[model samples]
Target chain A: MHEMGIALEIHRVCREAVAGRGPGRIEKVRVAVGELSAIEPDLLRFAWEAVTRETTDEGAALEIEWHRTEQVCPSCGPVPDRAPGTWLRLCPSCGGPLELRGGTELEVLDLVFAAEDDPPGPGGDEPGEESA
Target chain B: MSSDERDGRRVTRDFVRIRKSALAANDRVAGELRDRFRDAGTLVLNLVSAPGSGKTTLLEQTVRRLRDELSLGVLEGDVATELDAERIRALGVPARQIVTGGACHLESRIVRRALEEAEFPPLDILFIENVGNLVCPTSYDLGEDFKVALVSVPEGDDKPFKYPGIFRRALIAVVTKVDLLPHFSFDLDRVRERVATLNPAARFVAVSSTTGEGVDAWCDLLREALAAKREGRPWP
Candidate 1:
């Protein structure tokens, strides 16, 4: 529901980050969604479309990297791999109480854009626009 | 609003990869707000809970108890109304009411403005009474040194478990309206256990403004937090 606000933030940051790049369109953006961030990836994706419709990054892909919360078992130290959204309170091996360590992050990691290798000036060759 | 279905019912529009996080700018501002609060030598506490959690009442009681010893100000957030501010002003404390228009949560910008507008000389404590929403307010950081979550007895014991994020982020968890313990069938143990699971190091206090049961201890804890902030010590 609040994805619209998030989408606007993403747009603002991406625009600022690539503002100096030569005339080129953004191809993809990579964002990491932490397990405890309380964001629905699907909703965010939809919101992104609505926000970027007429922007420079129109039709840009949003690649989400899902981050799972890390649980630390008193006995085992760090649980290697656990299913997302599944709550595990005890260490499977020694039956020790597990502690939640991380995974509350909601941050944009990086953006990938197809910037012009050469300056888009008088001598530059025009590249045909392509859409997927 | 339904993206999955589109026969005049919904439409699914494909978006290109612009993979950016939507909260980058907000995070930056929030970071600055946090630094400002840390430098002010003030313990900013954001109080959050359900609608009738008695947050304003607790603040009124606290102001009456510690006004002489502490310089205090309050930032009250509601959809609309300066009534809470008036109530705090009646207690002779500097207070500002932040009408959030229709915002469900209080963000850093609003608190920053409230701080600028509030004229409290060298204050030791500032309490931000957040909008009475448990879910939306949990995600925002209003430049507070600590988050105090209130869970009244009538709201039931399962609230902590139901909204774990709020309880999880709180530095202090207070169970208010304990005067109704005789009338309500709340399992105290269950509430404590659930809150502990989400926030292992959180401090708990039970208080009733009407009966004055735990008011002293609650105010003492706040004073201790304020003292720790002034001395550059870690908060409890």
Candidate 2:
């Protein structure tokens, strides 16, 4: 759905970030996708491939790190029975209201780029030899 | 150069840590719009729901009852056509239609342009009727003081469980078409219970546009929200 829009935004941000650093090809892009972000990581990756097909960062790998939201109860502290995907309105042990924490995040964590200046080493160079 | 020379060179790889939100630009614009609403003392509300959920119908009724008490404006969002905006304008209220073309959600940039194009006068309330969608719209912020999710009786009570994203983020859940409760097998209590599980802090109001059954209560809640915004108090 809107994964295309998200992929475009990611490309724009990554391009800007890479532009400021120097000339390099992006090797990997790490992103944090929260459970509540409403973004499907698989679809986003597909969209990324489509968007970057002809760009300078073509073939760059997109790594998604999933994040989960936690429910914290006032009286019972963190609820233990509530599963990761399931939701609970009240604490099972104390019947207190539960508050949600974390999740709702969609951010670019880091970018790995291969510098252009580093070429193949000279032939017959010893392991301890220094090159200019 | 020999094969060893090619292998001896070290490839430089740089790892840059950013940790920035993907929607940062959109969020920034939304924050600015929030400041503008606060400065003008206008209570902004974003209404979201599926197509044919009677959102425009409920809005029409809401404007009719509250027009004398407060000045109101509306921004209608649709994939195409200005039919909804025309309907609101027929009520003599300032209304602007934002044709999103193919976008499923209303972003802050387009909303800013639409607000400017509408040339809205000083008003007590401004309602942004988001594109009839429940999923994509939940992720975008339109600088609204609160978000209201509306579902009709025929849409079934399991909507809260099936599409928890909107219910979790919305400040209020409105059950529309309650006049047809006898015809439909809608469980009011079950819907309320499920929505409560998703969002414990959300408020629910059941209304029927045809019979005006719960419109007064909905209006009262809106009035309270307006008062809270004007007084800079935390919303109830």
Candidate 3:
């Protein structure tokens, strides 16, 4: 349900990115979502569809690159045999606190967009709408 | 990563790299609020839990114990109703009720607005009782110094396993309504172990707001967090 808002923010970010780049409809957005990000990929994709409906960016794709957290003990490198999405309190070998690396990401890596109809001469942008 | 010509005039498909967070806007607002709270020397706490996790009850108990010792305020977040805010105000604490209406979770903007409306004195701590849901609330940081995950005894022991996202992100996982522990088969030790595995640094508290059991520990947690905040020490 809250993914709707996230989708809206993604749209905003994408459009802003496109505006800076050129006038083109967004075709696809590649995102990295981690396990601990508090997001469900399916729900986010569904929300993207709902939010992009009837807009110029309609049918835009939301490509999610899933990221998993790794448990690394300060004393003992990476803890092996632990299940994904579960944390280990202490290092099995060293009894030291384990620090998690990655798995909290919610980043937009890149986007693939197709050029729109009008290509403004050399600047790739309209005259009055130009950003100085 | 593939493209073709559209109309021979412009490149049909192009790729642009945008390395940024999807939650940048929300995180920015939360960060600003955090700075403001820090400048005011106030400790902010965000309480997350399921619908019947006794957040408001625990708050009532908190106010009763700490009102005389420290300045306190509450920003009550609910889908609808002034009920929780009224409960806190009835205890003589300055309370702001944020009626989220149909929104499942509270956002940072609303928290800022509620705090602005509060215009309270420099509070030792401000409790933002998030809407009764464990999932969505965890996504948004309310500039809280501590994220408290409340799980009631009736909710059972597997809550940490079921919603590991919240438990893993929380600074503390509190098992509420422990006075009814005799009636339920919920094992506290197992739950603690699970939380430890998920969040090694998370502190666990068994609280029964009804019987005022374990509230001393609860207050001690609060005081510790408050002290850390005021003294500029990093808290666990």
Candidate 4:
């Protein structure tokens, strides 16, 4: 599936970010997948695991935030009653053309990585210096 | 401290926000291709449709009709095969076949490579017949002036609703193989209505490549699109 290609892209993005931070291992990757996009979250996660296996980012969590397309009617503004995965061509109330808004997103949102000093282990009781 | 003790120390987890599109590389290449096409004054059309939708047949008819009036080039994409490219070349036009191996869709980078390899000449219009798929190809932009989606009568009238993502982004919707309409229970009006709902701005046309029915009208539409591009205007 094309999900493999998407996963590779995500891995590349994460690898670049990780490289910039010096020695580190990726902890998690968050991505936004839109309803209109062709990617399936489960398949993407599977592909990510396959791509990251035996790599520096092995065991990294893949988080997907689902983005739903907003359906709006020319006459009624936003249609709240429209069901998910279903399209309404016309407004149910006033019989006007319905429009879709903002559902093409496919981007890597953020990445969490453990620096070299911070090994994978339990947290210390004392809070360390916080960096944003 | 030993290595185990060091592992227990508070490790910092960095959060880096990198909001970038997965297809950013492809998009960048597509933008460059768009500039090149504009400079060449070429009106490029990216044709997408399901397999067996008669995209090649329609293109053959188009090449036959417009070869004398305008210069044309075709970049045919397939997973593995040069048959379609050969068909276009048989018409005496410059055609290149991009064998994508196992890739489902064609990216702008490969398209740029194919154009370079083919030594494509400056033309009035260029047609890119995408890999015959409705899903994967919709996401990749090939730097075309506009996209045209084709659906034959046998593909059923519900294709627009079933694959709204592609239909919604297409500038033109062509219903191919109209000659088979009498043999099959295909409702052209219903398909038009569905496609209209998906993409209100798309121009709809029905043609039979075999019988040459509505072929002139399709050619006229392409000519108009080419003229609009030359004048720096939008197509109807």
Compute the TM-score of each model's chain A versus the native chain A and list the values: 0.80, 0.83, 0.80, 0.86
For every candidate, C-alpha RMSD to the true structure in Å: 6.7, 3.8, 4.4, 3.6
Determine the iRMS, in angstroms, of model 3: 7.2
Q: What share of the true interface contacts does each candidate keep?
A: 0.20, 0.56, 0.57, 0.53
Task: Report, for every candidate in turn, its global Cα lDDT versus the true structure.
Answer: 0.79, 0.87, 0.88, 0.87
Question: Residue A96: error of model 3 in Å?
Answer: 6.5
| After superposition, candidate 1 runs with Cα above 4 Å error | A78-96, A116-132, B1-22
Per-residue lDDT tens digits of candidate 4, residues A1-132?
688888988899778767767766788999999877867789999999999999988999999999887878877798886677667777888988877787788999998877766444456444465544
TM-score of each: 0.83, 0.91, 0.91, 0.92
Per-prediction DockQ comes to 0.17, 0.45, 0.38, 0.46
Q: Which candidate, 2 or 3, has the higher lDDT?
A: 3
Indicate the DockQ of the complex predicted as candidate 2: 0.45
Q: Write the per-residue lDDT of candidate 2 for residues A1-132, one digit (tens) a residue.
A: 788888888877777777865666788999998877878889999999999998878999999999887789877687775565678767888888778776788998899876554454566333333322
- Measured on C-alpha atoms, candidate 3 has an lDDT of 0.88
User: How would you class the docking of model 3?
Assistant: acceptable
Top lDDT model: 3
Docking quality tier of model 1: incorrect
What C-alpha lDDT, on a 0 to 100 scale, does residue B178 get in candidate 4?
Answer: 94
**Native-to-model Cα distance after best TM-score fit, residue B84 in candidate 1, in Å:** 1.2
How would you encode candidate 2's per-residue C-alpha lDDT over B4-91 as one tens digit per residue?
2224454456777788888878889999999999999999999999999999999999999999889999999999999999999999
For model 3 chain B, where is the 10-residue window of minimal lDDT? Answer: B1-10
Candidate 3: Cα lDDT at B236 = 74
Tens digits of per-residue lDDT for model 4, B147-213: 8999999988888877877888898999999999988888999888888877788899999999999
lDDT of 3 by residue, B43-71 (tens): 99999999979999999999999999999
